[model samples]
Target chain A: MSAPLFEKIALVGIGLIGSSLARVIRRERLAGEIAIATRSPATLARAEELGLGDSYSTEAATAVANADLVIVSVPVGSSGAVAAEIAPALKPGAIVTDVGSTKRSVIAQMQPLLPGNVHFIPGHPLAGTEKSGPDAGFADLFENRWCIFTPLPDTDPQALERLSEFWRRCGANIDTMDADHHDMVLAIVSHLPHIIAYNIVGTADDLETVTKSEVIKYSASGFRDFTRLAASDPTMWRDVCLHNKDAILEMLARFSEDLASLQRAIRWGDGEKLFDMFTRTRAVRRSIIDAGQEIDVPDFGRQVVEHPGAVMPAAKS
Target chain B: MSAPLFEKIALVGIGLIGSSLARVIRRERLAGEIAIATRSPATLARAEELGLGDSYSTEAATAVANADLVIVSVPVGSSGAVAAEIAPALKPGAIVTDVGSTKRSVIAQMQPLLPGNVHFIPGHPLAGTEKSGPDAGFADLFENRWCIFTPLPDTDPQALERLSEFWRRCGANIDTMDADHHDMVLAIVSHLPHIIAYNIVGTADDLETVTKSEVIKYSASGFRDFTRLAASDPTMWRDVCLHNKDAILEMLARFSEDLASLQRAIRWGDGEKLFDMFTRTRAVRRSIIDAGQEIDVPDFGRQVVEHPGAVMPAAKS
Candidate 1:
């Protein structure tokens, strides 16, 4: 479609994010040679079977050899190890980046290990579904999604712009911020939501009076919405909770305090208070839709989209 | 197409659920005549514009004067008033039902006010979108969703069966349980989720560090899932919290306790513990999908379905 942006690009950790990158890079002709690497032999074989990349390897070092760009897509906890493995093999001018949820931890884990000759950038693409693994990825996974880059103070502007261009080509809008600010923003918007979802699901599962069958059967009322976030990859979330500890803890405390106030309002039968709180949160959803971050239809338009012609719109008189 | 189930059916409160009932009743030819009633003249006029009913009235008594079936779809707090208004005009052998989230309170509010000759069955069709009002309704809102009826001990079997048949024709499966058990079950499955969602969004909104712009920009990461529930009808949710106070308090207590333990796990960096909790919750989602209560596609298949041909599924070798 267009000239390849790089002579070669290596993708480490061929999970949902990595596999999606491979698909997009291939479709857009972003790389002349796409190399994919993962620790799991089965996953590597599966990637090769799907023809996701020009070369597949179980070793990260072998995959990144002579690569003009190296993108690591793994759990936050494994960032350091992958950085150590690929550091020596990376080309001098290669741009290295990551797709971990937490940016500060990723930077701390990989910055020192990466060779000084290469430009290292910590990034998080705020996009994914509950599903995981190589097969779960699709080429349009990052379409219209925000991919935030928390670059180092001494980071090369030219290299940063190049990587931004690369992500823009993959159908992502780019935003840059400080690593600490990125963690705080994500704590409220991403980490805390996932934690709350997992906690609620666990609570529902552990209930003695309410049968599990009943919970599942009647989930459409509201509980099913939380289940989607709770079903995300356990290993990935564990790393996130561990890596972004300070910001996540701060958010949890604030959330618990707010819950206490809400609980008290309910106990006192403060209908006005409850109604006020419930009414204000609605404007945020409206803002998100207006900003194009969310779908504009009701219930994410699942009912209408899932079964076309099943739901007829209101009649015109 | 089929024999009319009722000679005249009166729908009180022409909002999301009521309007949906109107659409489905007309589509399935379930009612010979559909009369719509609401306290709000604007909503009644809108329903009339949409041709959702054969006749429209502002007074519940006028709408149900000779109707064989009357369905009240209003906030739980208004159930008693509606019951009082329509008690004198209810037909001798009519069946009356209300679709409210809190069943025990609805029974307490309306059971004594309703006329003795009429069969009053307190029902809750566990179906809705975040959006409300008559214009938001579609014919398939109840399709494949559950409709739980908490009938009184002296409820007539024929009345219950006829009402269940009406719901089945509207494409909902029927379940019956004691009013108390229904409250407890719904506290966990529905009320708590909405309360927690509302609380978290409130927390995010109240934050001083993270800008509102940042939260909306990054909402797709996970926060947007909670926003859908938080954006629900405030008056309806407030009424639910007030009416189902005891059961909701119990569930909220359990949710907070569970959340505290999860916070501790994250603070202590217990990856194994965090991983286990996150992994177990995934099964609940799977069971929900298997039970036919939820869609099987990822992210409710929003991205794929919204932009058909935008996403190419993983290549098959």
Candidate 2:
């Protein structure tokens, strides 16, 4: 293996993303020493028990001391608080980054709190499972996913390159965009979908005529797909919505408008309109596949591998 | 391995579900002879070229003649017409079934046209990919999926058992439910999801600020999942919406109400409410995973895999 990417790395908030990073860093020897910290004492204890770091602490300032690199993987709402806690202890010229889903809000929240000497680049790794917590992480979680960075105007180029290199070794392709652009892109791609999913699942749950058990049993249709996204970390997504308010609301308004039109088409029995919209949307799936952003499961067997707790009897071959 | 389940089995359509059933029946030797018929001459010719049937015909009446089982796999709108066409030729005591997604509509449309002598059993296999056409099917599509049969009152128990046996041979577990109940269940489980997916994809497609390429490029987050369901056969889905209007409208109303509430929560910055709703939805996904309906991709790789053409590349591992 090549030499470690950083002499010492500090991780704030060792949840699914943080723990996964720890595992990958350990597996690939990406860090000489790993220091882990989380706001929750119980989570910190769990991380210690899992041996996810060389040192464990509840104090973010202590964790960042002497660290060459620091990653904040908490909910977007907590980025500022963590940055404030670690700002004083951050070593001069240390590269600092975050893995929040929304970029502009995170940058706004963290930039003012961080020391001027350190690189405070905001990023989002376009990857995650529905499961959270320290135990719900794996080494390959970042493999083949996109990691987008939104650096500030005065951000050091050398620091940005080093952070990009770190993500590259973590099995991601790097893309850089302005914070607002990233927020808008993610609002359409990620936020809106999750919001829609949460809405639909809640709808099904609130049904009086159709029982929940029936929905669960017959979910093989299309509902099951949305459930996976709907099941994402509640705290993180809640913060995302609150933090990226304008972009999400804009996308939601657009989505609601389009949905009203579709509802009209269905109500009016306009087959051609429905068919055209359905046909056009299919090409996007093909493009995503070509980009290598997902796996092809001929059957449900492959799904169990990615979610170990999701084991089911194999279909009789 | 076992005696052919039927001396002759006629398939009245050759689309995705129809062709998949034909392939499985052929592979399992569940029929001594397979006769395929569809409204379109081009599709009929293609099925013959693909060797999806032992005999091919354009006329539904001719195809059902002397057949012990006739499986009508046409769109729901055409169910009554096909039943009318084949009623006179259906052999005495023969089991007539369908693979329509909306059971109540299929039953309502077909029952009146069929002769009392023929056993008209409406069934639906809860298995399909987004792709359509005879070329999109495979022999193992039905394996481990549920095939629901909605039998009318006074329907022959022996015929029902025999049809269930046929589905079992095709590698599906048999489920029996009333047509109305099945329609309501599917409205929530299958129909609404597809409608929502189609609506959202249309919404993304019509965005003025976000380019289509940008949506496709970053779809790995959540939008790609919706595209898979939206990419389903337009004609089939359109027919389903028209035929199963009441149930779908009911579900849509409930969905819209729930969405309004979620929108209110987001607008008011009600983090607790958002967090609770998001948290509750997570368990349903777990139930779906427990029921073996979906695969769980880690933090980054959660793309839909229903259409072969839409299979995204697996993230770099």
Candidate 3:
């Protein structure tokens, strides 16, 4: 095996992403000493029980002391608080980073709190499941996924490269973009989708005619997919919405406008328009499959991923 | 192995569901002979290539002739045509059924044309994937899923019991509901979700600010879930919308009303309302998990079905 990437790595906020990183780092022997910290005493105890780190503490400041690298995997809204808590204790030249979905907000919240001696790079690993908490993490969570970093101007390039290599070892391909661009992109792709999922699921729950049993019974059709996303960590998503407000609202506005148009088409029975839009979206799924972003399901549950191209339908025009 | 349930079974329209039934029938020895037919010669040839049946034909009449049981699994729009085509050829006392998403319409379109001598029981196997065509099918597709049959008033109880047993051997529990109730239940659980997914994916595809590459790059958040549903069979879905117009429109109206309320909450920053709705929906997912309807994800890629009550979250008040 290759040499350990750092002598010590401190992971603040031992949630899904953090614990997953901890598991992968331990499995790969990428860090000599692992320090885990979270605000909740129960969660901290759970992390200790899982043996996810060499050291565990409820104090963020204590966890980052003398660590060569510190990863703050808290919600975007909590980034500033965690950064403030650990700033006085961070070792000089320590590469400080975060794994928040919204990049710009996290950078805005965290960058000002960290000491100038430490490198503050905002990163988001484009991977996760609907599950949350320490026990919800696994070593292979980042495999074949993208880890994007948004570095500020005047940032140390070497530190950036080192962090990139760190994520690569954790089984993620690295990409860099400006923080604002990352927020806008994620708003369209991730945040908006979660918001819509939560909305639709809420809609189903509020229905007067449709019972919950019926929804669960017939969910194999399409509702089940949204349920998985809607079932995500509520606290994390609530923080995401509040932190990435502008971008999410913008995306939501655009989505509403497009939905209005679709509603019009459906009301008018414009099959051609519906067919055209539906046909175009099929290609994006193909592109994602080609990019290895998702598993190809011939039928969602029946056909396993035996052959790559065999599972997806032929790309429709 | 058990004795064949039917002397000969004819599947008229060998697509995803049809071919899956064919495979399951063969695997369980449910039929002594299988005849597959579709309007498209190419699909028929493909079904033949997959060895989905003992006989393959493009003519529906030819396929159903002399068959003890005939299952018409086609797009909802084609039910009338298929019914007319096969009506004269059906054997006396044969059991005929369909596996269509929209049952009321299928019954409305098909029942009059089918020979009265045959027991015309319309059914909907509430299972499917985004993928279609003969190659997308497997023998285990219906395992542990629900199959709802909306039998006509004059339908024979013996024929109904026999069909229920057949579905049981194919790994499904059967429920009987009126066609209208089935349509209403599915409208909320299935149709609305598909429509919403198609709408969101189309919205993302048409975005001017968020580039296509950006959507694909960061889709792991929640948008990717919608993409799977959006990538469903367009022809089949289009027919569903047209046939089940009233139910779908009613459900869509409810969804839009709830969405408007959600949008207002977001706009007004009503955290309490948002939290309440989000919290309530989380319980629904827990119930679904408890009912053995979903797989638990440690992370998104790694999925396993947990034992009942193993992963149940705390119930929301």
Candidate 4:
């Protein structure tokens, strides 16, 4: 299929993103050979058992050897260690990148350790589900999604273009922004939402007045939506909160301030203010739908999707 | 199907819930006649055009006259006014019930205004989407959902049983709790989540560092989930906020307190604490899935649901 893009590609930390990349690359024939690596022997063994790669190893250095393209998909907190482990074996002129959620922290952690001969273009793919690990990934995980690259000022244009083409072939559109701006953007969109979700679920769990069984029973109302985000990989999220501390803290402060104002409105019975705020936020969802970032169906199409052949409301009569 | 549950059933509001009730009642042949009423002439006209009822009126009193059963499905704030208007017109021995989020408020507003000859019961169906209005309803909206009834202590048992049967035929399981307990339960499960969603969306919208467009574009990462709840009907949510102020504020206070502690953990880079909280929340989602309250698919099955032929990751290689 249009010739392999790279002779050899190495994927480090074969979790959801890494395994999905392996599947998509194989499907598109993007790489002539695939090498997989993770710190855990069990995960590496699972990857080999699933036939995800031509070669598998628990040693990151071994996987990076002779690889023309290397992707690091470890937790943000482990970026430095992975970079240190793989730097000595990376082939000359190989293009290296990552799918970390936080750009600045990852760049800060990896840039100095990576050999200057390799092109280290920092990236964050704005795609994924609440689930993680090798088995949770799907070949089309990046379909119609955005894969943002935060390239350094002195980065090579040719290497950046090649990486962009690679992501495009994997079914993701590309955007390039400065690393700080990327962190700030992701802090609000990804990090803050996950943190808030985890906190709210914790709050619901700690309730003495309402039983856990009751919360679980009636969660279809709205609380269940947060549970998906809350159920994400704890190690990954813990790393995110630790790595992107400033931006996340800033967004959290703003969120708390706004929540205080909303609490006050409820306390004062300010229907007008509550209505105005609720109405304004509705337009945001509409904009997201128009932008093709979300499904147009109600409740994310859960009812119809979960129960195929269920009667459509309009057709019931 | 079976013999009609009532000779005539009156609906005093024609919004999403009311219209859905009309459609379901017609589908099951649960009523000999369906009378629909709404304060908005436009909505009433639309309901008639949709063929959702046997008769339509702008006057709640006219709609309830001579009806064997009456269901009030209006914003919580309008419950008292509708109760007052229809009390004189309700047939003797008629079962009158309301579907409001806050049970105590609806009981307070409707109980004293009703005649002693009629049976007054309060109910809340825990089903709906972010959509509203007459056209946004379907017959199956209540299927497999919870329809909670908070009957007054002195309520007629036979009437309550009949009402329970009606909701069951409409495709909902029934639960009964005290008015105060129902409010508290819903405050944590429903009201708090909506308020948090509205607040978070407002916070993101007001951000200066992160543009609104950026937020919308990257929303799939996590922010979009909150927007669905934020996109719910404004008047309904506002009324819920005002009418259920005490329970909502109490839940909101607990949420904020929990959030503050989570914030401290992040600010201090307490990875152990963050990971523990995140891990603990994962089990709650599992409990929800195990209870058959949620779908087992990852990402709420959005990827496959939105694009039917998309490759499953396991099938790709």
On lDDT, the candidate that comes out on top is 1
The runs of at least 3 residues in candidate 2 whose Cα sits more than 4 Å from the true structure, single-residue gaps closed, are: A1-3, A296-310, A314-317, B295-317
Local accuracy of candidate 3 as per-residue lDDT tens digits, A1-317: 65699999999999899999999999999999999999899999999999999999999999999999999998777888898899999999999999999887888888888899989888999889887899989887887678989999978999999999999989888888898888888888888888888888888887777687888766767787787778888878877877778887888888878877776777777878877777788888876655556556443332332222222222111
Tens digit of per-residue lDDT, candidate 2, span A1-317: 66799999999999989999999999889999999988789999999999999999999999999999999999999988988899999999999999998888888888888888888888889878778999988887777778999888998899899999899888888988999999998999999999999999999988887888778778887788788789889999999989888898888888777777877777888888877777787776666667676444333233234344435645432
lDDT of 1 by residue, A71-185 (tens): 9999999999999999889889999999999999999999989999999988899999998999989998998889999989899999999999999899898999999999999
Best by DockQ: 2
DockQ for candidate 4: 0.52
Candidate that beats the other on lDDT, 2 or 4, i.e. the better one = 4
Model 4 residue runs over 4 Å out of place are A305-317, B305-317
Chain B TM-score against the true chain B, each candidate: 0.95, 0.94, 0.94, 0.95
lDDT of 3 by residue, B1-317 (tens): 65699999999999889999999999999999999999899999999888999998999999999998999999998999999999999999999999999998898899889877999999999888888899878887887778999988888999999999899889887889999999998888888888888888888888777788778766766677788878888888888887888888888877777777877776777767767776777777766655555544432332222222122222111
The candidate with the higher DockQ, 2 or 4, is 2
TM value for model 4:
0.96
TM-score of chain A, cand. 3:
0.94
lDDT of 1 by residue, B220-302 (tens): 89999999999999999999999999999999999999988999999898899999999999999988877766666677665
lDDT of 4 by residue, B45-107 (tens): 899899999999999999999999999999999999998999899999999998999999999
lDDT of 4 at A298: 74
Worst 10 residues of 3 chain B by lDDT: B308-317
Residue A221, candidate 1: alpha-carbon lDDT: 93
